[model samples]
Target: MSVPKLLIFILLIFGSSTAFAQHEEEKFDAAGTILHHILDTHDWHITDIPTGTDAEGHATYTPIALHLPWFFYSSRDGFTFASGTESLLEKGYVPYHEGLYPLKAGVSVAEHMDDHGHLEIHMEEEAFKEAYVDEAVTVIDLSLTKTSLQMILIGLLLLFVFRGVAKAYQRREGQAPKGFQGAMEVVIIFIRDEVARPYLGDKAMVFLPYLLTLFFFIWFANLFGLMPFNSNIAGNISVTSALAVLTFIIIQVNGTKDYWRHIFNTPGVPWWLKFGIPIMPIVEVIGIFTKPFALAVRLFANITAGHFMVLGLVSLIFIMSNAGENVAGGLGIMPISVLFSLVIFALEMIVAIVQPFIFTLLTAVFVGMAMESHDDHH
Candidate 1:
């Protein structure tokens, strides 16, 4: 998943001078680069495949990714929807410091000191974060960012793929499974047997659909990022938080009266603890939220950190290479770096499926717990 991103981040780290040469040399900013990779961005950084060098010695980069639409809205700032970077700038939205800033008169432009530097252009999306700006506060950025784009793409993919799977069932009724349907049936049955039936019991069918959706949605998003040039969507906190929120909503909406009683008026506790100080009730209420919060943070942190590790290892190779000054030495270290990255990436592949199952399993567990009555418990 971090393949292309790791390479780009490596380029950014060991002096963008070697990587950019003529386009725009960037001073290595490790913090900015890591944060940029972990957090959701306006642009999806497809890999930069090198084209022929220009007459002026600038290396040409053919970026394979898409630039999603940029939307900015405010009562004073007015609304603007620009489909691309050029269009966004044309509308007077300055790309600066991880957000769209208002481009007003006398905006500070990037300067090059002949005594120390080469031509530096802040116009490109890559350099947007460090692009200097004096003014321009942010408005609502309802644009299709990396996360939103991935979500949309994955949603459509599920719709089409599962639609075909559904049709296969109709045409092949009572017949043996074939191809895609067969593969998915295996997963579907596993979820039904291991996840839904185990936790949900009698109401397994009622929640089976949601549990399947949760498992497939997450697993799909994770695997989607593994596709060449795709951005890491599941690693984003907002996306994980949304998944957690859905679990929370389902838990509360289906909670039995006993669930509320357990929280607000926890049983088996002393009167002093329950009514005198309101300690157990407060703790129980907080516990309800903590479950979902943990779900969100755990998924976000794990995926992000895994990507970070891969990128960091790749970056280390370049740093050791001294930006390719020592080609032999760099090549020597390449095998080790690649080996370690592959090992972790393989682990991440397993984690992609495991994490989703964990989330769905926990969600089912929570829901089942909430549905229990005094009679069932006793």
Candidate 2:
């Protein structure tokens, strides 16, 4: 059979098996069970307790709940805090559910003055009930979340790398670039030629650093999301929204006087038509806002969808296991999962690089449009 025919046969077999596995797994809710195991078993370090056996053959206290690493935590009450790690787990406590972190019920020991002396008070879990805590806040808002720290470090490293390259170029004058400088020179040159110059003209150099930074940061973040136990920083809508807002700001601020005037006052139109022409400008302004919104949503949706698809595919095994280990299920599903994962991995690599290109390309297009001069045509 032809390659296409073979592929189609494989897909049909894979799809049917996947559906059966999902049905089997659904009977026992294997996906939920597995998810809970992964999420809950991970420590977020809120509080710790001791519960191990002692040398005297009696129950002894051993440190638990030592290090809880959480993304974000907030309370409906006035009190709020973001720490490097959840501190409550050092006492040997575990998360209430499998994958859900109770951000609000964070407990800490407090000192209170009493008649005898200083007393340590353990805040009851009920205290948080009245407090109304929300751990679902944006990971970016979390104090020293691993993802946030990684982004910062990535930014600083890129800065130093680029700066060093720039210094080398300056010192070498007209000589050929070498070492790290040479490697970066090639990339910068590609960005200028392929991405920036095609859209932004001679003035593109001014925006090169911003474009480079935006591309590398986002690309790296997306790649990082694929790592085991890593947070999906780029997959989060807020991060993409912030990037879109920046693009919006740049497009508006860099807009020339003519750009605005053309919107408000058309150069060639009838007296009656002038009034109607202004509507075009209003629409144009709205378009500017919509462009960035589209950018943000597109990136976030694509990244997130890819992740969900991969997870769903991987979950097939546990689902099929419920049906008495039918060798057909494992024989069928594992190869499909492996195959699709490889394909998706390749796509992700392309996406990591392509997303940045599209973002920077659009930003450049907007910037170029803002800087256009009608009179220059004459």
**Highest-lDDT candidate:** 1
Per-residue lDDT over 224-256 for candidate 2, one digit per residue giving the tens place of the 0 to 100 score: 766655556666677789999999899889889
TM-score of each: 0.81, 0.64
The digit string of per-residue lDDT tens for model 1 on 212-279 reads 98899889988876555566877888888999999999899989988999998777778899989999
Q: Which stretches of candidate 2 lie over 4 Å from their true place?
A: 1-79, 82-146, 163-175, 178-180, 266-282, 323-328, 376-378
Q: Which candidate leads the pack in TM-score? A: 1
**Model 2 C-alpha lDDT versus the unseen true structure:** 0.62
Kindly report which residue pairs in candidate 1 clash with one another.
Answer: none
